[model samples]
Target: MSDAGDKVARIRELNDNFRKTFAGGMMMMTASVAALPEMVRSAAWLKVSEFDAWDTGNDPHHEHDFINFELCNRNFFWKCDYYAPDMNSGSEDPSDPEKTVRVGLLMLAEDY
Candidate 1:
């Protein structure tokens, strides 16, 4: 693959790792998600960890940064937003883990 393709692949792999392990990045949830029962919320988290439904329709950029799913008949989405290492602004190079800090958000679809 070309250099650019390799970079994007690395970015996707790092993003997926952050989603599954909540490591190397921060995680935030909407108020509605925070209000869910502990058991239900735990289940939802498991779903997030196990998510692997990416495709052209939902992941056109192929970054693996956003995901939408259903739980208990309710719509939900998880998103990863890239920021600078300082956490003050967007990253200049999202493909570089050292230059970026990822923030994952979990929220109701309506909240998106």
Candidate 2:
């Protein structure tokens, strides 16, 4: 293969790896939420903005802009947010979120 072909192949491989890793993390987040619904239940009193404001990033500008996928119980607060060069808009939508849900459901189905 030519140098450009090799580079393209490597980029494709890296992108695949990133997707798989992110899928796994999202599955874990969903499982934790479904397994402990009481803990991760949608807040009623607080406004959506308050929940969105929990994003604690090193970058001051990103704090308000960030959203967290949180799994909090009495003792633990597990959170995972997608990080990419671009905005995290892809994960914010539900249509594609089903892909993550399918991954979690498949694993959950397998375990039982």
Candidate 3:
């Protein structure tokens, strides 16, 4: 094969590896949430992000942006929203003023 063909093959291999790793992480996250619904909910209230597979990367400037996860299970999907409590004018009670919240949402894919 040519050099370009070899490079393409390597890239495809890397992409496959990344996909598998990410999928495994998502499965683990789903299991964890299923096992500890209350804990997850409490953490959400506290704005404690970074669940097993998901991280919001909580940047203040991109609070409205979302890190999306499209799981293999077509029924479900996940997303982590970087939220700035202080910046939001709609809310009377915000969780944290200085730090952004990594709000994780797991919902039906159809609903999303």
Candidate 4:
């Protein structure tokens, strides 16, 4: 296969893995929260525009080095932390760079 084809394949694989992780994360998050119905509704209504990427310049807290996305609905809000596998370290058994693990937490506005 061509180099471009290999790159495309890698991207597709990453996207597929992300989708699966995101869906499961959302499910577990809503289930764990106090307001299950409201959480589900808010999650269902989530929009891409509402997501705040943790590493982006918009995030003011540098101390928390995790990559996360925030979702909100009315007064309720939550953050989903995505732990992407590191690929740059020079080691024989490096983490799987393509794998992404996520944790979602419900929070109040003033929790930060």
lDDT of 1: 0.90
Provide TM-scores for the models.
0.95, 0.23, 0.29, 0.32
Residues 2-112, model 4: lDDT tens digits: 765565454434333443344423323343345546755556335321343435363343322122343444344444454544423332311233354434455444444
Query: Candidate 1, residues 1-112: lDDT per residue as tens digits?
Result: 9988888898899998999999988999999999988887788878888999899998998899998889988898989999999998999988888999999998989886
Go through the candidates in order and give each one's C-alpha lDDT. 0.90, 0.32, 0.37, 0.41
| Clashing pairs counted in every model | 0, 0, 0, 0
RMSD each, Å: 0.9, 13.3, 14.4, 8.6
Number of the top candidate by lDDT? 1
Give the winner by TM-score: 1
> How would you encode candidate 3's per-residue C-alpha lDDT over 4-58 as one tens digit per residue?
5564454333323323333211212344445545754344323322323334463
Clashing pairs in 1: none
* Per-residue lDDT of 62 in model 3: 24
Which 10-residue span in candidate 1 carries the lowest summed lDDT? 39-48
Candidate 2, residues 18-80: lDDT per residue as tens digits? 333433333333353345444244431122223433333622422122233322323223222
Sort the candidates on TM-score, descending order: 1, 4, 3, 2
User: What number of backbone clashes does candidate 2 have, counting pairs of residues 3 or more apart or in separate chains?
Assistant: 0
Task: Predict model 4's lDDT versus the native.
Answer: 0.41
Of candidate 4, the 10-residue stretch with the lowest lDDT total is 87-96
